[model samples]
Target: MENKEIILNILHEIKNGNIPVHTDYNLNLDMWADLIEYMHDRTYIADVTIYWFGDDDTYNDERVHSVNLTKVRLTTFGERFLTEEMN
Candidate 1:
C-alpha cells in the first residue's frame, strides 16, 4: 500500500484505541520504521517504542537487521490529519 494509505490506517487504528497497529506482512520493516519515525518526529503520533538490532556495537553491523514497532498511538494532530485526509 501507499505510504499515505498506511499512515491513515495507522492513525485510524490508534484513534479507535488500537495500541499497536500491525502492518501487512509484505511491508518492508525499514519502510515501516521510517514511516513511524517520520510521524513521531512530526508529532503526529506519540507513545511509541521502536526496537531494532544490527545497528549497534553489540551487533557489529552497519545495517539494521530488524525494526519492530512495539507501541504507538495517535496524537491530536494525527487525528486532525486523519480527519482531513478522509474528507
Candidate 2:
C-alpha cells in the first residue's frame, strides 16, 4: 500500500483498538522511518495532535534499536477525520 494509505490504516487500527492505546506504541522502523514523519507532518497540518514521540531517554534506550517508541491516540479532530473524511 502507499505510505498515506498505510498511515491511515495504522491510525484507523488504533482508533478501533486493534492497536494498543495510551501506552507506548512500538513501530517497525523499516516501515516507519520513511513514512511516519510524513504522516505526522500531515496530522500537524490538519491541526490535530494524534501522536507524541517519546522523550530522549526512551529514544536512547539500548533495548530498541531501530524502532521508534511513540504514544498514539485519536484526538477529537482525528476521530472526526476517521469517521468523515477517511470513509
Best by lDDT: 1
Q: What is the C-alpha lDDT of each candidate?
A: 0.71, 0.49
Candidate 1 global TM-score: 0.72
Cα lDDT of model 2 overall?
Answer: 0.49
Worst 10 residues of 1 by lDDT: 61-70
* lDDT (10s digit) by residue, model 2, range 1-87: 554556667667767656422222344543454354455565621322233355356564323233332445566665766677586
Task: After the best TM-score superposition of candidate 1, give how far the Cα of residue 10 lies from its true spot, in angstroms.
Answer: 0.8
How many clashes in each candidate?
0, 0
Full-model lDDT, candidate 1 = 0.71
Model 2: lowest-lDDT 10 consecutive positions: 44-53
